[model samples]
Target: MTHQESLYGKTPDQLAALCGELGMPRFAARQIARWLYVRHTEDPLRMTDIAAAHRQRLAEWFSPALSAPERVTESADGTKKYLFRTLEGHYVESAYIPDGERATLCVSSQAGCRMGCRFCATGRQGLQQSLTAAEILNQAVSLPERDKLTNLVFMGMGEPLDNTDEVLRALEIITAEWGFGWSPTRITLSTAGVVPELRRFLDATKVHLAVSLHNPFHEERMEIMPVERAWPIAEVAAILREYDFTHQRRVSFEYIVMSGLNDSPRHIRELTRLLNGIKCRINLIRFHRIPDSPYFSPGDEAMVRFRDALTARGIQTTIRASRGEDIQAACGLLSTRLKGGI
Candidate 1:
């Protein structure tokens, strides 16, 4: 059975090409874009502006192909974890977090992660497959609160930079004028510093960036995140220094503080030395304990003290509030729970 291509993630240009190939009027492309994005309508028949004779053919050749979430777990803090099944039958999770006036959707870029970060559950499952741009965009387009979503963070499941081509394609559709037209500032891509791809991303888009720099020292970071050995945090910082993040686009270092591990003043000193002269903020994240994990989250007082130490050094820092801990929806907790079985 050959699967029909999904039109939900296609940009206006691609749709225009499809129209040209199908012998349909070029104007039909914009109509389809309006139906898919502005009107949020997926059914070709419901695209009333399109010619009646072409609607059936359009539906036959392409499908909206938005897969509904297989399961939804809501947390007490108004955070919802949505498990979506990829076309390949593997599962990935996206978290929708609502904080007062702000609502952010954390999206996944792949089925399982290949980065192999020790603290990450997704990394534990290993790499299954990469999601197409359609699969990635479907998570947002099919959301119940899609209209209310204020921000999108590529911080779930996999290293987005590893899937650079599809991730960039999705970003283009998300922010293009004929697509969703959302501001690039509202989207942030987080990566464990795949240097070349990170450089490519920085050159291509102005979306905010968050680099996983859990430890300042190379050897210490390599202990948990193996990516450190390939592209050292120092080199990542150097690459970032070449760009100008002092404007609207922002860059931040994600430091997941582990108890008695990287919460000392020495780490702060090294961090200050490493990130010196870079116009960026540091986000201190509390480590969520996984099963049989060797690390533990630091106490609130300890976190506050670390934040104060960095702030006193003229660096802007914030202790990110941990959410959905009960449902395992926080950082590094998203996984399929299936191993070799499927």
Candidate 2:
């Protein structure tokens, strides 16, 4: 018996090719897409339009994939953390946040992260293989509450910009008419400002962009994010300057506030200076402490003061409402935990 084709990885174009190879009609691709994405129909035989013989043949060759939540923990505030076991036997975590009317699922791009951010839990593990487009999208597509999804972010575990090819291909599959068909506006990809990968992403997609700039000063930033030692935030900002984010797309900075460490009026001034000429919002996130991290969460008062300081300097800044804290599933907390940590 032949091995099955990975149904999760097939793009519409790939699906069309699959249908052609199976000796099926061209229109069969449309039916298959409708069944897969629109109707959420997983059973091949349920596709009554396809001939019975072809249905069996297709079913034998393809199977809809799902990373069933091997472990699910729900927080008091309705945030859910799911540990999904990939087919490769790696466990990656994804979070589903239910905000009053809309639900957002934060997906992972790689099995583990390579970028060594002092604050992130995922960074403890060295680089694992990049997730395939299927693995990346399945975080949303295979979720039990997938139909209720209103937004998706490549912000769960891995640094999305590092896996540029897989990330972009997955976005294409997500927004394609034959796939999830979501507007690019519904998705956001975050990075620790990897300059070259970031340039390619900005040119190729209209999805919202978020740069992880925890500290504005180069010296202090380098202490936390090692990438800063190579591609400085100044260079990242220069590349961003070339893009027009005025109306079509959004651009934002993710500044995780560490108490007395990187949260102060002085830090705010430096942040404002760094973003001097740009029209972008700064989201001040509360620091989530990891083991041996030595960072403390910034108090609300300090966060508010910092936000106002940046705003007074003509920079749009907002202190982000911290979520998923009760579940140990907030910012900088996601990791595959595949081998129970290093």
Candidate 3:
């Protein structure tokens, strides 16, 4: 049996086109978008505002495209990792972090990752498949805390720019007025620098950009992040310099400080020189050790020292507070290896 196409991720324009093809009234497109996004309902029967005949037509050809997570593991620090089985039977993970008055949902853009960043668990799984836009949006739409979320991050399990088309569609649905109506500033996308797609992403969306610049030196970065060989971090920074980030929209670098790896004074000096013209902040992340991994987080004092040294160089830097490490949901630790049960 063939599955019905999903309606949940369609933008207003796409929905309008769909409605036209379905022989429904044009206004029905807006109603369906409101029901799918604003109301967060997947069942056409729940769309009370749409006419019965039109709703039936919608139900016949399209589904709401939402899926509840199969399992959840919560950390003592109020971080939760949700395991979701994708439509293709592959599994992915999403991390929910709740801070005072601000809750961020980090959603995955692909089932597994193609970017084999040495430190990232997701990349080790190899590429399963890029998620459809519906699957991407469902991470937020079907969340139990959907209503309470204040921010969204595309930093979960994949190189988002590698799955640029679907990721962009999901972003459009999240921020469009006829959809969730969220401000672009409320979202951030993390990438390990896919230069061509990065250019496309920067041109198309106003969401905050976070480049994974774990190291400043080219050869050294290539050792940890293979994307550097194809699209150098220096070139990524050069592309970023073309954009205006001194205003509301911001660009930040995610530097995972591993002991004896990337947390040296030379790295700091090179970082300062590499990011000289860009007005941006550096987010120093504590490395989380994965199974058999050689990388280790330098303790708090070293992290603080590194942050201070960068700040002393006139670049704003802050250490990202480690959360959900106990549950393996923190940065560089997300994977679906245990998704079969967990």
Query: What would the TM-score be for candidate 1 when compared with the true structure?
Result: 0.95
Please, what is the TM-score per model? 0.95, 0.92, 0.96
lDDT of 3 by residue, 1-342 (tens): 134688888787888898888888888888888888888887888899888998887788875468898889999999999988888788899999999999999999998898999999998988887999999988887789989999999999988998988999999988988878999999999999999998899999999999999999999999999998899999999998898998899999999999998989899999999999999999999988888999899999999999999999999999999899999999998888655542
* Model 1 poorest ten-residue lDDT run: 1-10
Clashing pairs in 3: none
lDDT of 2 by residue, 1-342 (tens): 244446565566777887888898877887877877777665688889999998998888775565567788898888899887666677788999999889999888887788889989988876767888877877777788888999998888888888888888898878888877899999999999888888789888899999999998999999989999999999998888888889968999999988888977788777877886777999989888888889898778877888888888888888877678778788888876645442
Task: Report the candidate with higher lDDT, 1 versus 2.
Answer: 1
- lDDT per prediction? 0.90, 0.83, 0.90
Residue pairs with colliding backbones in model 1 are none
Q: Give residue 114's error in model 3 in angstroms.
A: 0.7
- lDDT, candidate 1, 93-211, per-residue tens: 99999988899999999999999999888888888889999889889988888889999999999999999988999999889887789999999999999998988999999899999
Cα RMSD, each candidate: 1.7, 2.3, 1.7
Candidate 2 segments whose C-alpha is farther than 4 A from its true place: 1-4, 338-342
Off by over 4 Å in 3: none
Candidate with the greatest TM-score versus the true structure: 3
Those runs of model 1 whose alpha carbons end farther than 4 Å from true positions after fitting are 339-341
